[model samples]
Structure formats: C-alpha cells, structure tokens
Target: MQKLLIIDDNDEVRRQLKWGLSKGGYELTFARDGVEGLNMFKKQEPSVVTLDLGLPPHENGVEEGLRCLGEMLRINPLSKIIVITGNEEHGAALKAVQGGAYDYYKKPIDLNELKIIIDRAMYLQTLEQENQDLRDSSVADCGIVGECGTMQEVFTLIDRVAASDVPVLITGESGTGKELVARAIHAKGPRADKDMVCINCGAIPENLLESELFGHEKGAFTGANRTVKGKVEYAEKGTLFLDEIGEMPMSLQVKLLRFLQEMVITRVGGRRDIEVDVRIIAATNVDIQEAMQNGTFREDLFYRIGVVNIVLPPLRDRGADIALLANYFLKRVSAGAGSRGKAFSPEALEYINGYDWPGNIRELENRVKRAVIMATGPQIEPDDLGINGGDVLRQRLHANDLSLKEARMLLERDMVEDALKRESGNIVKAAASIGVSRPTFYDLMKKHGVRNA
Candidate 1:
C-alpha cells in the first residue's frame, strides 16, 4: 500500500484528512507541526505529503510549511508534496508550487478532489522509484559483487570511458562478463536514456548479416517481403553493441566501414542515404588481429573499432575473484530457487579457487546456479559442485605430502602440456594460446625441464 503523510497544525483538520485518506486504502500518518512532519517524512519515507500553510508555533503563516516542503524534497527529490492554503493565502500557495510543490489546494478542502490529486502523485512517485531501481540493478560493478584489485581497475576504466563518446572494444575469453561490461558503459553513458541495441555477428548467417546491419527496402531480396529498419538505424542517437564481431563476414566489413566513416547508410535496393548518430561498441573472444592477417577480417575495420580497447582478464588469472563471484551467484541463484539460505562449503570454495576455469565467469555462475538447486543442505559441498569429490579427499589425506616447489612444478607441467595440445605443439601459437608471452612460455618450459616438442 502507498503511504501518505498529512501535516496540519489544526488537530481537527489533521484528523479529518487522515480518516478520509485512510478509508481510501492509503497507509496514513499524521504530524501536528512542521518539525514533526519533517521527522515523520524521514522515518516513514512516505510517497506523498500534504502540508497546511497554518503550522504550529507559526500558525496563520506559510514560512514553516514552505520550509518543510523544501526539506522533504531534499530528502527525496521524487517525493510528491501538496500544499494546503486558506482562501486569503492564495499567494503563498502559488509560491509553494514555484518552490517545487506537486500541486496546491484552496482551504475548505474537497475530499474528493484531494483524493484524486494524491492518487496521481502516488502513481508518479512509484514509476520514478521503479526506473531508478532498474538503472541501479543493470550495472556490473554496481551489481557484479567483486572488490578485487583487477575488478576495481575494470570498474575505474568503465567509469572513465562512460563519459566519453569514443567507441569501446571489449576483448576477452567467452563468458568473462563482456556483455556486463558493455552494459555498464551504456548505463553510465550519456546515451543511457536511449536504446542499447545488441547484435550477435556470429549468430546470424553471412547472407543476412548485411541486411541485419543495414535495413532493406521492400522486395530487395527473395525474403524481403517488406521494408525493415536494421539494428544500426533502430539505434539512432543511441548505442549499438556488436558481439563476436570477429565472426562478421568479409562481405559486410566494407559496408560497416562505410557506415562508420560516413555516418550514413542506404538500405538495400534503395537510393536515399539515411543518417544516424550511433555509438558503436563491439566485443569478441577471437583474435581479431590474427583474423585480419589470415585474410578473413579487414585491417582498416579493426583499427577503426579498436580506438578504446578493454581486454578483460579471464577468471583464472583474476586471483580470489572466483570466491567472490561464487558467493555473488550463490545468493542470486538461491533466491531464485526459493531455497534455504545457501552457502559454499570450505571444500567447495577451495576447489573453485583451484580450478582452471577455462570458461571464465560464465562457467562459475552456471556451477553455482546448479549447486543451489541440487544441494540438499544449506551448505553446498564439493560433491554437489561436480568437481570430483575423490580428488578433494585424496588431497586432504596427503595435505602434508607435497612440498611447495613440487606442487608448483606439477601445476606448471599440466598447464604447459595443455597449452601445447591446444596449440598443436607450435611454441608461438602455444604462448598466445595460453595468454602468455613467448619469453614467459620459454622460461616455464626450462623451469619444468620439459623438452619443446
């Protein structure tokens, strides 16, 4: 129920207004003076407030009433305040409206009219609150639950770039929260009020990619039954996010570049050029530079889109963030599943931190979501996480068996072997494949006394 505050120095008037409003299905609170009204406003956070011009200790005056209105607005800018004034105090009521009152009423209050005004004010306040909540909930650093140094740097970069109009290129492994970062930029940017259209270049077929980027006129092709605006046109004066841009076909690259350069596009089978003011934000997991060299992606397009690049570090490299992300996801998943308060067991947290996490943040979220649903107890164990409970038990049994150097050597050996397999034993490719420089790869091989295959 919506809450309403009625402030009047006259006891009879306050009681009457409170009774009438309460009968209309509103949660009502009454204050006998301007000071009491401000106190009640702070404590209850009512949606709407009605203040009488004649206030206690300053009766037959508008000074105290106007002061209360200003204080209420400062506490909650979106609050709706209706000022009540006597017939002779019309000037004061007009001044109150100019002072940010929602609406004013003459004395000898009409209960019916007052009810209508209050209802409208309550509706507007509710809408504003909901919009603010959605804006707060959509951001990553704001909603993503991480305080690691790496995450802090990421947040700082987002804050810096959100105020500019420069194109942003987000590059990271799949499921490393690329889209979340993109959303943070859009939500905090100047174009936040406009649409943020998203297009997955890899998901669409090559034959349709061009038409998707730039709209088509009626009968442009076999399936072009009607004219349709493309993603770029639809996002005019807003933001357009192109995901997996590395997968965009070469045929469409020229068209995209033309659009970027000219800030205009002609629909397929149409002659008139349409102009747009769109900010482009592209993301990808693949090596776009490699694609450029391999004759698949265009070099000019790469330079154009990568003016401001943000390479997100994968979850494994982001030490200790695994636990943070796990806890964050656990809360969300537990609430969604309607389960009892769920938390990760000590063993489960250890296994999560120790895992390679090749799939990055996305994989961790999925594991936690599943665990929340599958766990029988309040505390989720390693077994529920599907991380090989036997391995955990064996490690605990031999906790003092391995030296620090031996443990480090074993991990290094596994990583090098995996990198070699993934890169087909090419040292250069293996180095890039494992996200390490060539010098670092060579040093690791020598340290572990492994032969270059």
Candidate 2:
C-alpha cells in the first residue's frame, strides 16, 4: 500500500483530505506542521506528500514551507511532493516546484481533481524510488559503507585510479576496512570480472610466504609434492591484494620489488620466469614510514607499490557514521537471524558516541553482533556491548559534575594510558601509535601522572 502524507495547518482541510483520500487506495497520514511532517517522513518514508505553502509560525509566509521542502528533499529525494498554494500565490507554487517539489496546485481544493494529482504523484514517486534503489545497489555492490568526507575522497580516488592498472597502497588502522577498499577499487575497475587473489604477508610463515606468493615447483621443498600456482599467477589480468604488506620480510620485499618492476615471477627452485599481468593493491595497519625507518620495510618496494595511496580514517573520527553503520549492521544482522527488530537505548547511544572505538569499525560491528545475541530486552544497552557499561552509566549520572576542561583532561589521561598499554609501555611506540611524537607522548604521560619509566 502506498503512503500519502498530508502536511497542512488547517484542521478542516486535513479532515476533508482524510475523508476524501481515505477511499483512494492509499494509507493517508496527516501532519499539522513541518516538524511532525518531517518526523513522519523519516519514519514512514511515505511515497507522496501534500504540503501547504503556509505552515506554522509563518502561516502567512512561505518561509517555513520552503525550509520544510528543502529538508524533505534532502532526506528523501525520491519522495513526490505536491505543493498546495493559495490562488494569489501561484509564484510561490512555481518556486516550490523549482526547489524540488514534483508539482503544484493553486486555490481551493477540489477533492476529485486533487485525487488525480495525488495518484499521479504516487506513480511518479514509485518510478523515482525504483531508480534510486538501482543507484543504491550500484554503491552497495562495492561493499564499502561510508558517507564521511574522508571515505568520499577515497571513493573519488578509486574512481579515478581504477580505470588504470596502477599499484595502490591502502594504509589504515587494523580494523578500518582496508581490504574492503581494495576490493572496491578492483570491483569498480576494469579487472572486476577476473579473480582477486589475496595474500596476507603477516599471517603466513616467512619461509612459506615466498612459495605462497610466487608458486612452488614439484619437489621444490618437502611440502612441494606437486607444482602449485601462486597468488600472482592465479590473479592473472586481475587484482593481487597483499594484506599486511609491511610485514613482508626484507628478503621477500626484494623479490616483490623485482616482480613489480619486471611483471614476472620465478617459482621457488625454478629458473623459469613466468610472466603474469596483475594489478597490485597493498594494505598495512602499521605506519610504513616508521617501518622503513626501523629497517623492517623497504623504501624502494614502498614506492613501487604506492603509485596511488588511500588512507582510511578510523571510526572514531567519522562522527555520525557510527550511528549510520550501527543501524545498517543492526538491520542486516537482525534480518539474517529472523529476530525481532530492536533499537539501541538512549544511554547506549550516548556511550557509543562518547567512547573512542580504538579497534575501529570491526570492533563496533563485533560488539553490535554480540549485543544482538546477548541483549535480554528490546533495547541494547552499553552493557550489552561489553565495554564497561557500569562505568558509562555512572558517568552519565555524574555528567554534569565535571566541567568541560576537566572532562577533556580525564579523557586525555585515559587515552595516554590506553596507548601505553597497547604499545607495552614503550613511550616511543605508544606515541607513534596515536600519531604523536615521542616528546609529546612523554609530556602527556608526565601531565597525567603516568610514569615514563
């Protein structure tokens, strides 16, 4: 059933529409003002909306109506809005249509004539919604979920770089979806139809990593009973994703550099060089610059595979996307389990917004999954997320007790402690982990009463 939302200030007009539109194959809903209308629009996602040009505090003016029109279109561009204006204000109706309303009608409303407009609006809304769904499907095909500025820039870079078979280096915190970005780059590019072979440099043993990446001939080693093709050959004319590339040993780095330069790989213990065409997309959680300085990673190899660089921002920095991703995951997980839909409690949202997600989006998603399974009630509380809910609840009670500066100091102190813990109390490593220099980390430790030693 199609939904029709009527936003008008006049009570009698709404009564007439409720009486008239009730029989027109529609689920009719009414809003007295702009606020109610927007709230309903967001919740119901109505197909068509009938909006009055004179609404609320500005009953004689079109200011509030225009604002509502803009917000409605921003929220759901596919919604069909029919602007209802006074006969004398035909110009305002035209302005509303120009501002994104589908169409407009002037003067006293005739139930029969307005019904035709409403039905037509519903038909057009259906068409627009279908087109919008197709567009969303295209974005979803890439499997990257983000609308933040940084991610937007990364998407733009991928669009530009994907057309060419170039080497791309994606660097971010461990759980920031680097592999997803790599897949998106390949999937959106010309090589999407071919295989995308992945090799985790850090996961495989150093001795086997070479065989895994560059194949092994029969009887090359004890396990090499048969000639095995490697990731490079398997991904011929496709993509080769090297996850945790920073963990590639220096010896393997030399081989990788040569492969990139020559576009050929020699099997272990085999003198024959096999030429293979593959696009390289490498990712690492660690700071490559720091690794290169520490002599663990090669600078030349970095330059070779880093023709295009995309850095994914951690979840904490993405702000509102936390809620967006949370809701997205909630719907997906709940649908998979055939479970009743549940929402996050208000306090849970507060904790979600305040707590820094050190493990990034993966942690957030894992916690949400746990909450879905473990939550005893309809609402998933901070406790359900398994991140010190009692502390968050207590902090909420005493939120007004701390001044802004005091809160900032307390959060900063905790951050320093966490960084130190994560880095095993190595101040230099801890500083680097949090994107700060050693001296600045020492100052923070000192100010927070944390022992540098």
Model 1 C-alpha RMSD to native = 17.0
For candidate 1, list the clashing residue pairs, or say none: none
Tens-digit lDDT track of model 1 for 1-453: 989999988878877786677788789998989888999999999999998978877797778898899989999988999999998899999999998999999879889999999998997787577545544443453465445677777888889999898889999999988998888899899999999999999999998888888889999999889999999999998999999999988889899999998899999878899999999999999998889889999999988899998888889778766786777677667657776456677657766776667788988888887777667756787656766533433363376644464465457656876788888789999888878999899766644334566
| Highest TM-score against the true fold, candidate | 2
- Clash total of candidate 1: 0
lDDT on C-alpha atoms for all candidate structures = 0.82, 0.84
Off by over 4 Å in 1: 1-142, 389-453
Error of 1 at 268 (Å): 1.2
How do the residues 1-453 of candidate 2 rate in per-residue lDDT, one tens digit apiece?
999999999999999989988999999899999999899999999999999989998999998898999999999888899999987788888899999999998758999999999998887676556445434633446766677787778878888888898899999997998988898888988999998999999999999999999999999999788999988999999999999998999999999999999999999979998999999999999999999899999999989999888999999788787876776677667767888568887656766766678898899889889889978766876657776533443474476644464466557667878888888888888998888888888766644446544
